[model samples]
Target: MVTLEQVKHQCRIDHNDEDTLLLGYVAAARDHVQRYLDRTIYDVAVPSEDPDGVLDNASIDQATLMLVGHWYAHRESVSETSMNEVPMGVTSLLAPYRHIGI
Candidate 1:
């Protein structure tokens, strides 16, 4: 799982005032990335020192960051958009992780 600190850092936030809001964005991004890749990317049991567990993949990390940034930037928008829609960069980053079952 991506910690609030990580997301805040990615977002370049230096205060704790919006910690609760940022946490929600991080969770939403994690779930979005997981669904896009059709696999669990966060909170998996692994013997690594990183608390994010299986989120060691750089592409996945970037994707999540992109998502968080998007959500943060678009928070006040009233336009209707698909929740599953993500930026092109994020989609490209997640492409390799996508599952293609026969």
Candidate 2:
């Protein structure tokens, strides 16, 4: 997870402004999602139980699906507020994969 201090330091250099909690939160959120996808999708492991339930326990397809669902559920509110704007880059990256319905 990206720490507040790390985010603040980067933000200060990027935005040339003082560190703010909100900025740190945004950065951390993005970092968290990216890291989650990277680890879950790239690293695969066998399911301890119900092997049949998970076709490929090691792949991250399920986790990605879940994350996508969660994002879609919150898209409306996230799109509405300027302060909470989803990072454009991240949103763009996930756009093509957005399922039509939850």
**How many clashes in each candidate?**
0, 2
lDDT of 2 by residue, 1-102 (tens): 333444444334455344464444444455454453332211244355623222222122333333333443454544554554345444454444333433
Give every collision pair in model 1.
none
lDDT of 2: 0.39
Query: lDDT for each of the candidates?
Result: 0.74, 0.39
Tens digit of per-residue lDDT, candidate 1, span 1-102: 566777888889999999888888887888888777666664445555533334447788778888888788788757586666545688898887686556
* The candidate that achieves the highest TM-score relative to the unseen native structure: 1
TM for every model, in the order presented, reads: 0.71, 0.24
| Regions more than 4 Å wrong, model 1 | 42-55, 76-88
What is the model-wide C-alpha lDDT for candidate 1? Answer: 0.74
In terms of lDDT, the best-performing candidate is 1
Q: After superposition, how far is residue 23 of candidate 2 from its true place, in Å?
A: 7.1
